[model samples]
Target: MRDPDLDELRAELEEFAQPEKKASRSPREERIIAGFEEIQRFVDEHGRAPRHGEDRDIFERLYAVRLDRIRKLEDCRTLLAPLDRQGLLSGAGTTADAGSDDMDEDELAAELGTINGFEITELRHVRPSAEKRAAEEIASRQRCEDFSKFKPLFQKVQEELDAGVRETRPFELKAEIRPGAWFIVGGQKAYVADMGEVFTNDQGRSDARLRVIFDNGTESNMLMRSLQRALNKDEAGRRITEPVAGPLFSDQHGDEDQASGTIYVLRSKSDLPLVAENRDLVHKIGVTNMSVEQRIAGARLQPTFLMADVEVVATYKLFNINRSRLEKLIHRIFDPARLDIEIRDRFGNPVVPREWFLVPLSAIDEAIRKIRDGTIAGYVYDPQSAQLVRRGTE
Candidate 1:
């Protein structure tokens, strides 16, 4: 009963309504795009491209290497050029930071892996020979001869966990490997006691030896990759959070009981000749649970601000940390650079401000980096070198 003309019209309209086919990319191109996007995310969050340095976190160093390689390759530049809204690719060479080469381009690509939401292009049915050897090293654990020294640490971690001062969360990245970091693997609490110098493996990948102490008093000198693999394979693998004071910083926040605060670095805007002369070098480091704006209000009326207006140089938001202790710890690290200026309050009482230090902003950035990775305990800021040096080395 239908008209032939009506049927023909409906068929034509259906053809017009079909969706356009997306441009398909080759696996190699997809991998390149995925890797570049990771760098882009890093830039977005950190406000700068990752730089290379021993003081820099391992992941930042990896990103620095990755960015350098991407710049060198014409194909990567071409593929990522359209997506470089931040102009991250326009810079020449990698950041000039102090560190040796860890991984070449191909290995770095593999390390970045296929980013989430992308179809994974690479997979292996069998573990690599190097990874297999690392697994063996982990399996051949020895009784820690100096277990007594580490016993108190394990107990303290447990106490903190019970007291809700520290909590454990899922472990996701190999970059988390560092001294003083704790993890739960294979039904045991594992701690990274120390890490050795970064070295290139025979496979041309960046790696380091880790001294991992188990709560059971067994210890293993395993390659960093081994611990990563173990954690990835275990269903219950978790990274134990750090104590609130000697805090290990985590990005995750919980609703019930996570303490959050900000670490603010301030530069005095006083017109005083000495402060004006060294304005760029002097900074006040403080941590507060309230907003920085609220805390800095009435700066000109407060001796703590040198009785002058101030400029916020930087602020780092932290979670589940003791702001007071963190403030004190940072103060202690830069104590040698403490500014010796005396400012009078509205009551005409002279008071020497304790928080201000005559240190460059870059040095403060490096100190925060060490603190986030839980390595600040072993480092002290040397004003002569304007660098964070090992305790015994300086």
Candidate 2:
């Protein structure tokens, strides 16, 4: 009962709607493409092509090796040419190639499996939960998008370290994890850019998240507790102390200036053989808010005064500065000449006297003058020369 012309018209339309034939690739070809894509992802994330080196991450080394192999094979190059938007093939590979040319199908598969996501059972040696967390936290580092903004800061810090304006100390407490604080962990400088609001955890301990940026242009948002544990575990981890700043002394204290303390240079009057032999060179550098005479009273009764009366050789009044930090600075400057002699206190206990140095009064005066003018950071106390010389000269 149907018309032949109408049925013929529908068949024509269905024939025109058929999909086009697609190209087919074997499993080997598919695997090659997938591996190349992984290398491309690495380049995209790190802003550089992976290179072979002992210091590089394991996965990156594998990628470097695989890239070299792919470049050697004419077939792989032809297949990957269309996808080489990063011009990875055009660039030269690193000279530090490792391993043999025995990258068979099974070995390549194993390498690929070791990357991306990791399984606990795959680890050869099991680690504790905290250690595992710390490892994972460090491994999660990625290229920082705003690294250019921090490059200058890292350069400045390096300069300060070279000039003796900054010092590295053992990291011992969680209280040091504040914003703007810097540290050296895993052989890289880490700056604490920001920290989240403080909160107590189930263990009744305060904790917070930190945005830590690294000198290698990487960053991580690890927890404060996690960073603390990482620092404790890393042997090279250290806290970068803040550089000394502001004027150490002021004449005719202004109305707005707060009197901090005075830096007093004292020569010990101890009759010990070493002290008597080098009395002129044996001096105590101290900072105190109390009167110099009052602080030195009953010197013979105090172990810190070396159980001997002391003569105040010089004093420089300070304003609006941290007395303890200023004292630490002077102590560190003259630490090489520190008196190593030990004495017994009135209680019959052995006590080591600190703040006493074997430096001459002339050098101490020069250091005080440089410190007042903020040039002390560029100089150091040279025990051999018996003078304050430029830091690099010694």
Candidate 3:
């Protein structure tokens, strides 16, 4: 048997469903009533309140329909009401209505609130495509996993930096300011720095300054050019510099061949201790499990330290670690080895012919922190299970 509330709601809907007998009701009012009946039918089928979940697509469509009805009803109200008092009827209309001016302000406000509440509720039902796109953009901006907490950490780092605390180590090296001798700093996907045109004065002395050139032809010269200037003062008057740029060698040959000599040149510089220090920090942060000593001892090891040439090396290393963790999660969730897995690119374009799953770095970091704090359930998928079973769900 249907519930008493459902029966009553059905009866109310039936009353509005019939043709209006009075002249007060118009075609717009009829359409509004029809829309209300549709909403009632949807509620009856769901047997619960509309909400955001896997079925968001349905929720949003219904919400938009409901809003359209409200708008039509508002339009009908405006047409029937007197010009001076029309605002009192629709609540949002701007008609001055001197007759309704004498009405209680509190009652008018309450009526306005009702309309606004309905409007806001409908707006919450955002389409999945738009929601997904917004989520991805937010994720990209926050490149790290723990974005929520990272803001404070980043602020603290910046504060320390402003107070002359060198959290980043700078590498010291002597390179003759010559043409085609560019040093790439940061990492494999390092943000490129511009090498400005070498300017020569009449005195025959070339002002050896490095300038960052953008695609727009604008330029920004390196502020602190010399290692002596960067390391002149340290904590308690001791000189300590952090490496922001790695070394690179370039010849007439392609960039790949140039990288070999660049690596060799960086490795031979034993006097500069920044590379070793950064390698140690990378291991300590758990981004890399291998120590510098172990890496040096390996059979595949070469004479050069390639770590010096990349720009923002430490940040990029962190980015890679985050990507690896996300890949593992995707593999576990879909179990590609067992099922027909399909992956797609950012634009929903087919990529790798396997199921693609993405978790924003910020979201992943926040999830990890929550798990540690015992605020949320933390689970990693097992490839053998081929199901989305929680870590302690047994």
Candidate 4:
């Protein structure tokens, strides 16, 4: 106890050792420490740091402000020194920080990478789920990356369509939908590029994800069910397929090939009051590819001819005619003046004749001429005037 030099040597050794660190902080330091810790917890939850952009949630913006103040405050930085495991403190108080005001809008957007150009300039839409899917199917379109491979296929398809080998039919619900199929949608021909996996929903309906490329330099990632719905709603939608037979129209030679169909106009002879009263105006019009005599042989036995004797009013030889199409056109032209006459057949059963019309033969002759001249489509039969007039004039 009397050794002063030895005690002084011991005290000097103690001073040379490292001092112990502070274990606690003051109230002011603790307040800043709590605020900074809250922000750190947010970063731990969301993979990125908080941002002050207007697109962010209000709570996120408030946390972003708190984080900014905490970073700039020296006391707060010192209080939370042990929590900086990701080196976030090194970049604090700089323009490169997440919530820094010195950063430009473009720079901040590039950092987040959330919105694209399409979403930025678009407005919101509300619709039914089926209609919404259809809208997205058309609206969310893009240029296909690998369309070069499909160029040749489209060219060949066009060639086949021109040659009459491939034709379009009405889109059906039960039709086979698969990859590499072509369909008419939104007035454009779309080709199914690839089909993804087949998935079933809660309702047990099957569907597939598809990449549909259009002729207008656009494409979409659509579902099979969506395509079906869109096509069913569209009046013009059709499926493109190659038929087994060859072209519908081909050049023919010789007199036998040049033979035209026979257009026979017959007047029905009936004892009924309605038929006898308008026998002169009511005429039964028919077209046949075979001989007119052979066609009239079964006229008396059939109910279509009123089951009575028939008078041959006029016969014109149709040249190079489509018999079925010609008959339909003739029926449509006289549809307005169709005569509603009923007569009892040989068995005394009441029957109505459908083909009899109370129209002038001259008008019928004029319609046939207009059809032959390729101008019938421009006209419509006016019931009031009992004459053919320009379609829009009516």
User: lDDT, candidate 3, residue 186?
Assistant: 17
**Backbone clashes in model 2, listed as residue pairs:** none
lDDT of 3 at 136: 23
CA deviation > 4 Å runs, candidate 2: 1-13, 16-247
Candidate number with greatest TM-score: 2
* TM-score per candidate, chains pooled: 0.42, 0.45, 0.19, 0.37
- Screening candidate 1 with a backbone cut-off below 3 angstroms (N, C-alpha, C), the clashing residue pairs are 259-320
The most accurate candidate by lDDT is: 2
lDDT of 4 by residue, 1-394 (tens): 5799999999999999998987887655655555556566767788666676433443344456555555676866776778876445665422334444333433332232312210112223333452343233333566777788777667766644543335687988634578878899768888988899998854588888888888877777877877887788879999887422221223333464444477788988867677788888788988888887888886777777888778888777654445665677678778888888777777888888778888778777777666644456567777677778887897
Ranking by lDDT: 2, 1, 4, 3
Encode model 3's per-residue lDDT on 70-146: one tens digit a residue: 44665634543443222323434322222322113222223223232233222343444344322321111113333
User: Stretches of candidate 4 above 4 Å error?
Assistant: 1-260
User: Superposing all C-alpha atoms, what RMSD in Å does each candidate have to the true structure?
Assistant: 22.8, 15.2, 26.3, 19.7
Ranking 3 against 4 by lDDT, winner: 4
Q: Which ten residues in a row have the lowest lDDT in candidate 4?
A: 114-123
| Whole-model lDDT values for every prediction | 0.76, 0.77, 0.31, 0.66
6: Cα error in model 4, Å? 39
The sequence of per-residue lDDT tens digits that candidate 1 reaches over residues 82-184 is 9988787888423555655444534433443423322124533333653454233324577899999999788767745653345788998888889989999
Candidate 3 residue spans exceeding 4 A from truth: 1-21, 49-55, 68-394
